[model samples]
Target: MKKTILGLWLLACLSLNALAENIYPISREMGSGTRSAFVDIFEIYKSVNNKKIDAIAQKIEITNSTGIMLTSVANSKNSIGYISLGALNNSIKPISINGVIPSVENITNKSYTIFRNFNVVTKLSNPLIEDFLAYTVSLEAKPIIQKAGYISVSKGNFKSKNPRGKLIIAGSSSVTPLMEKLKESYVKINPNADIEISQSDSTIGVNSVIEGIADIGMVSREVKESELKKGVKPQVLAIDGLAIIVNHQNPITNLTKEQVRKIFLGEITTWEQIQ
Candidate 1:
């Protein structure tokens, strides 16, 4: 009889704890460009409000091998999840981080305050990594990074100086064009520097960097605060515009910020009423 009573008490306690805890699985890497940006804002939440996050929420059960699997698990009404602002495809909704939604305008203006630039991170010890890092800081890669959904760090003369060895680069698809451009431009000046580029999404890229799979990782979004322990460096590449695109057939050319908010909030549906 005592065991039964104890079991019930334990179950009640577990249920209550579940209700209070919110789990968020963030990438594991410190200074990862994407995760760092996200974590910075998450830290603010922890600072202002005494909210705790469980990084390993639950051992999510998965059968399919796809990124959508994570999104599906995260989208459960019982859970709050986050994905790259560029990759948000209606599967999961981002919860408000300090009362601001992650949007292009808000991120650019620093109003949303959580968005970060996708970076090109490489080891400081490697001469090749140093060279590539220097190359990325150039003016040429700026436009490419902006197109991929990130803010660039403005520095002058990226490729003028060459570091001594082989260069290996990795990360998001969004950053591929810029990396390719960097490689092509650098090889022309230093014909002996061996350079290779690999592609992965933000989560996978960060994981690779943590595991030492590549010299650098490219991420499309900001990193979460929990991921900052992994020693990755996030550098801003360019400012990207996240536009709310509509079908060309629609006559609407411009939408006031309030109207756009209303549409997303389900307050307005009809196109006729928008005019």
Candidate 2:
């Protein structure tokens, strides 16, 4: 009789814990180009006395890279986050925005609007850098880009001059996978070329190029005006969207743009509120 009473009390506590589950909004740390693009597309900015400022909740979970974003959302049953569509995998579920599902065809046809450009920034020009950058945007790279789940937006040509030099690429984790594929092909053509990729957020990539620390910067968002002013030239490599992902346990599949905007803006605080 005492054992039965203890089991019932434990069950009651479990039920209460489930009932108290609330939505956890996860965001990337500052200086992430992905965060900038998501915030801009979702209109998460607020005008306070005519001065615009970011309005993401002050206490939300913040991650440093795309991989971490996926891990955080996948680990938490109530967490919601965003990542590059190309980097998306089976670990988490991507909820459709509005009625449009995120797919390569949908993104290509303009049905999926929450997308950003994958750019490579270069502050100085050289033979190896020029060849590598051209190869990334050329028609030859399309198959690799497509295979990696990103949309190709360029059809330029690449001819192997067999340029030999060491080059460093630093930037967005979203673009690193595609870049690695391209690096393999480029190195085969020019065996003497050594390519190194250091993955981080987009802002760091662009800044690394501008500061002369890296030869190429992988920026997932459009090149900023300030960065352009600083003389880092951008070349579009591919196009990708930010996928709204949640833990696989979350049953809610589709969210309207308004609901998403509100959630990110901190207006909607609980899972029950959205349901």
Candidate 3:
């Protein structure tokens, strides 16, 4: 009789634990450049043939901003998501994919494949613009970028000219945090400079520069061929990796790319399926 009572109590505890856990999948909104690069790199398209098909059906929480995505995943113990490595923090855990971890060493050696370029779009260049661009790839800026969790571009030979003017940089939310750091450092040397930043999607940033709405547009991915025809020039800024993150409490250490693909496709709905 005691054994039967103990078994019933244990079963009840297990049931309660199960009830407390729920898996949440989060994604960025439709127009984000980060979303575009992520889907393209993962081959998340529905069609196997040379034709278009419906997108994969999955119940996901769509966030308009990277900040919200970070917050949502940080609060849920069973949630999984992705964010730029620059935005990574200890609030959540990043997982290994395909037997490799996301790190500067991996990225520097080209072992990490899920990276995109930081780009700036401009309609016309002037001395002031050229100076600011040079500062971005200078030796001094490298450590600032590295400290912010991003890889710096090659230190170029361009010399810094004192640029003093109001510079408006607008675009990719993923790039905004890193840009803010750059802005802080830039203004310190050029106290006469006024730098303003805005976070719309990347496409808007490109368009803003082309239309003269902003002095420079920040883009997380390479400038699309379509946008190039609009007479906008692209300057490569930095290289950033995308980190696949999950709640720190999740015990799963590594995920194969195929497993991640299936999970996002809604084919693997339960954590038990992977276990």
Candidate 4:
């Protein structure tokens, strides 16, 4: 009787441990939709493996926030997080799965599976927004996004007459380089157009656009459905990849989507366990 009770208790403990696993977002990462898709893929992989996976970290929470800030938080040990390639800094490292680190070469060629298109959002009613949108769609701004760490969606020459009006653009710092590139090109064509670019998180950028404070909003993530209800249309300009990097010293290479989720959720906590 005693032995049977002990056995039952052990089994129950194991079951509870298995049930503790879950998927959640890492704060500061770009592309919430991409994060959602990654979670879905990780869950599917775990189901096939027939083993309960551990959480990499709890859902990332932030106070003073940006995608880069959230990414910095998530980049800590045993944590799997994603951020735009342009946002990478010395503090964080990208993860390698199957020996492939997400990069421009891999993403552009479609060798990297995790990627999404970013947008240049604007209000339909604002003429300045319309002109900026037109310029973004023109051939001049296409290569600029690519040069700034994103992949362009279209190719065409811009023919708009320079509007001599002041315009404001706000978005993630990850979008800064792309924005700068676009500004340079736009200025070349319409030398008199006054453009100002501001850096902030995706949420803040969207908010500014909603408040009518900015003519154009650039975001590394898709506009939320809620934002759509407010009259902001996310016009996709280019595709970008969120890279998961690691310290060069870490020997482990190649992590599956499931493993990555586990690492971030604080489930599997060591390099050896990963092996």
Which candidate tops TM-score? 2
Estimate, for each residue in 25-136, the C-alpha lDDT of model 1 and write its tens digit. 2232333333334344344112325664322212423222124433554444332223455554445444444445556667777776544455555434466666667666
Cα RMSD, each candidate = 15.0, 4.6, 4.1, 11.0
Of 2 and 3, which scores higher on lDDT? 2
The TM-score between candidate 1 and the true structure equals 0.51
Using lDDT as the yardstick, the better of models 2 and 4 is 2
How many clashes show up in model 3?
A: 0
Per-residue C-alpha lDDT of model 4 across residues 62-156, encoded as one tens digit per residue:
32333545454445433345566665666766776556778888887777777766677776454455666678767767767666777777656
Candidate 2 lDDT, 206-262, residue by residue in tens: 989989999999998889888999999998888898899988877668888888889
Q: For every model shown, what is its TM-score relative to the native structure? A: 0.51, 0.90, 0.87, 0.71
- Using TM-score as the yardstick, the better of models 2 and 3 is 2
Worst 10 residues of 1 by lDDT: 56-65
Assess candidate 3 and give its lDDT. 0.81
Query: Candidate 3: lDDT of 82?
Result: 85
